[model samples]
Target chain A: MDSMIQINNLKKTYSNGFNALKGININIEKGKFFGLLGPNGAGKTTTIGILTGLVNLTSGNVLIDGYDVIKDYKITRRMIGLSPQEINLDVFFTIKELLTFQGGYFGLSLSESKKRVEKLLYDLGLEDKVNAKARELSGGMKRRVQIAKALVHDPELIILDEPTAGVDIELRHLLWNSLKEMNIKQNKTLLLTTHYIEEAEALCDEVAIIDDGKIIAQGSPKELIKADGESYINITVNKINENILSDYNIDINENIIKITSKNPEKDIPNIINILSESNIAVRNLNVKTASLEDVFLKLTGKNIIDD
Target chain B: MINTPFLTLIYREVLRFIVLYKQTIMPGIISSGLYLVIFGHALGSRIGSINNIDYIHFIIPGLTMMAVINQSYANSSSSIMQAKYLKFIEDYLVAPVSGFELSMSFIIGAIFRGVINGILIILTCWMLTDFNVHNYSLSLFFLIITSCVFGAIGVIIGIISKSWDQVGVFGTFVFMPLSMLGGVFWSVDMLPKGWQFITILNPLYWMINGLRYSMIGISEIPIMFSIIISIIFAIIFTIIASVMFSRGYRIKS
Candidate 1:
């Protein structure tokens, strides 16, 4: 497996003695969208900070394309681009100025920066906003500009920290499509953290579910569901008769009763006969497969606030 | 991606203030001009002939350096504090740019503001009194170097402060009193002998003396010490501010 980033037993203990990352080990392959899933304060930002060389780590190492981040910072930094959670920009600067300046920070000549800025603005649907001040940009455009600024350096690895939060569905799809193109067309390695479970499930080929500074589950979304057999049967009684559920083999689960017996069809007939005799009618029945969100909620036990 | 460089950083800082010209530059100029008008009206006529020069001529250097120092300090302190408050400074942290680059950028921005203020003050004073600034080279040298030095110190203040309130805390508690007592509008020689010695220790006193020497061709303190002290303060403050930045001192939070 060709890993673009390999973090080994990564740990970060803050000055106040908060352990943000605990023995985290993960390998991200090249040209793939790797999702780092966690509830708030589960240390997603901290991990991103460490990988991008912003936060100091107490122990362990991060290797970006086999380049040690600490020992060889220049080369490692050149390989990665970080779109931070905060929209930090010189509000006085125009979008074109910001991108060109960012390009210059990467050592590109004026003409070269100009070329890159033009292409990026056009690609990110920011061509019309090239002259707009950062303060004048809408929230979605600002987020896109942030991404464009990061891409100005043209790094192989791009780390987006919650890029889709507070954005409308149209902009979300726009961002996702651009990110997908970055991965599939340009072969960039993208590490994105998102609040949208659907976004993660639809986009990521692999995910790590972190809770309380530990990885509880890490696998493909489909494989995670398969690994747990996250499927269920639900049967609701029509009438208000508790007796239908009692004196029966059907397992009760809140409003919807359940049964995991070998023969659901055979068991249904018996359940119907017993419910009819007790004056309880069958209202609704279902056999459903679990979604990625169900697996996420079950593993992490925190509602992922899409807002 | 842009490669963060020393020049790029400097350009950004310069652009930062220039684009927001009113907030950074105009107040200093207008304030200095008002002082020139008010003080030139009230005191210039009464305290005549200090070391064979009119009161207004004697005070021009002091008022000019005063504007430079205040503006330089405010620009650096306010900009950094705002960045910190808005949580926007992490952009610099993740970049390959070194701490020295960031510190120098802010300091240079302060210098830019200070120098512009000094020029405005000098121009206004020239129009009001037409004072034949006796030694042009010395006055120019002192103004440039002093503004640069005080501007660097502003970077130190910005690095040390946590909030906008802290700016007032430092400015009112320290800069205001020290500047007033530094003999901007008068001579230390006019004071009692004991107080004169205390004036020698105030760094702003030497700064004013250097400017005085340039404008009126005389100074209470040796012009040599004034020049040397300004350069020394510049080096000390630069070293301190850069060290704070390099260690990631206040930026992490």
Candidate 2:
């Protein structure tokens, strides 16, 4: 597949001498749902800003498709649609008007803009709020409007910066389904920056974990989670004792004991037999695979929401 | 198709203010009417006339220029500042529009508001007084040039401001005082010789004089000089604004 976005050693330093992005490189393939995970101040938005021409690069090159961002901004801008993390719509404008105006910004005529707006409003489940001012809509509806605004021009690549931040679960699922449909039916490339590790695990085919202004790890969610082939076993006994599993890295809390097992299938049975011999009845047990959250924690050593 | 982006941007800007006409357009008309009543009616009889025109008539040109200048500056400056604070400027920043096109759209939008205010004030003046517009074509020419200059100045102000208070400071301190002392209420010849020279140096004074000449065929300076100064100022401010945008000044970083 051809690369949709290519960043060659990108760097960005703010006026206050803070380096937001340090010698970074990334290439997003065409027609892929890519997730960029990072903690606060991890340069995710900074990279998005550069890609959308909202920030000047300190040094390096960014190519969208085959066009350099700085030299061919017109073409690059027309090729990408960004729904920024913040709610930046004109509050006075109605939902339909905002989408129509945004389409016109991309050089669409009024008739063309209206046709696209109608479909976007209907697709995003905002047809009822079409005439309502943006400020009058609920938080979830406003987010849906932002997404509709981004997709109004029908750009080839869509970059969403935390599109689900502060959104309710029911609305989030709706947004996810819409995005999935777009990615599948339209073959559109999407770059999603989200703090919800579970969301990334559920939707992203590939993920990149960025920390301290650098991308520390990048791989498919499952590949990154189980690349070490590590799993864990949790056992519940009728009673808990400290020295019961001293030969392993065991964590005991009350009547439960957790152990890291290289092979859960083989380890669970042997561990159960030992517990049976010790006069402690094994009440329940289960094997748990490493999740994307664990991988993110292992790489960054901090929670995604923490600074 | 060639003018789609440019025209759309201008349309959006124009619609922005038009939708908020209660806040944008009404205030200028009401305020100009008050000035016509207080300054043109209450004080016109006492101040007598200048250049063989009634004091009420003489002040109409000045008041009309004031409306044009203030509205032109306020329209662009407030529009940009609002977009910046609301973070909606990212819409254009990420779009396919060029910096020049963006700047021109705002300038033209300001001109629209400025011209509207000027015309409304003139209509109001005609209702109360018998002030005749001496040269219709020249009056339009100077009105457009003045609006362009002030609108360009507004863009520069909008780019430099980090907060709305800064915009207010420019209006209250810089623009307000300049309009008052720019020979709006008095003639330049009334001042001492040295003071008259200093007064002529003010661009706002040239704008008012140019407008007065267009409306009444009497000016403290040559009409050509006023035209040249207004055009040159507009060009210089436009160039500065375009460069500031291209550099991504405060709006980007």
Q: Which ten residues in a row have the lowest lDDT in candidate 1 chain A?
A: A259-268
Which pairs clash inside model 2? none
Off by over 4 Å in 1: A233-287, B1-4, B133-140
Specify the poorest-scoring 10-residue window by lDDT in model 1 chain B: B1-10
| Tens digits of lDDT, candidate 2, A259-278 | 98656767777787778888
For every candidate, what share of the true interface contacts is present? 0.36, 0.85
What value does the interface RMSD of model 2 take?
A: 1.1
In order, candidate lDDTs are: 0.80, 0.87
DockQ, all models = 0.32, 0.75
Candidate 1 positional error at A25, Å: 2.3
- The list of candidate 2 runs beyond 4 A from truth reads A228-230, A237-257, A262-282
Please report the candidate that would top lDDT against the real structure.
Answer: 2
- The sequence of per-residue lDDT tens digits that candidate 2 reaches over residues B1-253 is 3767678889988998899888878888888889989988899889898878888888888988988998899989988898898899899788887788888889999999888888888888888888788988888887788888888889899989988999889989988888888988889878899988878778899999999999888987888999899899999988887787777789886
